[model samples]
Target: MTSGPAIYGNFTIDDLVYPNGSTRWGVPGGSAVYAAMGALLWTKVSSIVAPLGADYPITLLDKRIDLSRCRSIPKTMRNWGLYEEDGRRHFISRNESRDWTYFSPALADAASGYQAAAHIAPLPFEATKQLIEELRAGGTKSISLDMDDHDLLGNRSLKKMMELVSTVDLFMPSQQDVLALFPGKGPLEAMHQLRSLVPEVALIAIKCGAGGTIAHLAGSEEYLRIPAVHVEVIDQTGAGDAFCGGVLGSLARQGDLLEALLCGAVSASFCIEGMGFSSLLEATGEAANSRLERLRQRVERAPCK
Candidate 1:
């Protein structure tokens, strides 16, 4: 594989509450952490731009991940997600210390060398737009975005979402996110409507839990349905973020959409096998390739028109 571009992301800490009344507090969690791990599995140059709190354990991250761009903050960003018995998640609370409502010029400067490709994890609409603008101005070749249900259903305006989508090379959103974005529409209809909203996006990937992903490439009337890898799920947190990382990493290295999708599917499979990025610690390129081959066999392509 060719040398991958420097991958960058934002990070967060999580406080999870399960239906069983158990809780995991102050866990080192975020889209950046999972996405970086997924990218690291394919390439060595990966970094996360986040604010680290005094209480966070920086040593837990892999040595390959560069935290030079991250800031030191008085308190870490905290989020609460309550899981129901039916696998639905409800975010109960959020306390953000360092406001990322707008883009950070310091982060833009730190991201100078790694402009080959970047993945913007779930952030405020304004932040996402600003980051994309900064990266594009800094000569970044490819940019990807991952949107969650919260982002879709939150206070963001449709115009902001459309502008953000049109700016990125790839837009990866969960099934629930798409449903929320285009309410009262089926998956295909929602995807088409989204495509109409952001006709310039090179690819739109809808991530379906357990079922897999449906990816539509620009200028193509057909889309690929890539199935998810079967695994015994331990915790579902960060799976989608890992998937975004895998795709961005693969695309940066190989520039092939199909390969990227497969890599993402495999990465997500590993993420779900254990709790909070633990399974990924034991993941190898060989193992990922093995699963990739299996998933490639199950992928189906059909016309979207």
Candidate 2:
């Protein structure tokens, strides 16, 4: 929020295991990085408010991103990411206890005196709720939350999820999260049910991974499902986080929900084309806008049936 928007999440060292049995070590990975890069594609400034470990590669972040608010911690999160043939991912923490105390810091203290739209990556339910309350209390203009499936499928109840989302302007959950939150239901139906549960959220989007996304505006009968941009898949680690960045960044800058959605899809397209967020971070505004135009042509309103 120093020069522009900010992303709050964790930074991690990722050791990736591919379905083909290939291995990549010492990769920079995290939702915060991917989300910032996604926003940086269209916005001139995107700041990160997260803990940085000594071993993390600071150079991996683009020059446009601001690290002024990032705090130094004993260690950032570290994990091994394993990908399956169906694109399902399994994670194993490198640290015995995961030692994730750095994951949820005092965000309002870290990002003091800032008032801009913010995107929050997945965190524990209580931690996320506290951050949202603090951000709102600090006069943050807008908030977008992307939840973890584990949190949804765990002890966090649907009612608690509803309560948490009501405080934010945007709520984007992956397709897996939606299904788990509403068992025995499809994405669209889950979205509808969620809308009924919390009608105050301005926008609710369900990220369908390679299948694209379906989004609904509060109080509207219509919803739109946009297709993902075709790109050779490399690693899907941070695609969904990148998508949230694009959407929140665009919304904060232009105040256009639909345009935000398109930007998100394009952002995710760039994410999947490389390990971690390398490809996504390499994208420029012109390249992103070009892809947005092409994606705009393919967008169609989904049937409400």
Among all candidates shown, the one with the greatest lDDT: 2
What Cα-based lDDT does every candidate model obtain? 0.77, 0.84
The per-candidate count of clashes, in order, stands at 0, 0
lDDT of 1 by residue, 1-93 (tens): 222444444455778988889899877777788998888777766777655566667788777777766666655566787888766676543
RMSD (Cα, Å) for all candidates, in order, is 2.7, 1.6
User: Which window of 10 residues has the lowest lDDT sum in candidate 1?
Assistant: 101-110
Instruction: Residues 210-237, candidate 2: write the lDDT tens digits.
Output: 8899899887778888899998988888
> How does model 1 score by TM-score?
0.90
TM-score to native of every candidate shown: 0.90, 0.95
| Alpha-carbon shift of residue 204 in model 1 (angstroms) | 0.4
For candidate 2, what is the TM-score?
Answer: 0.95
Off by over 4 Å in 1: 1-9, 92-113
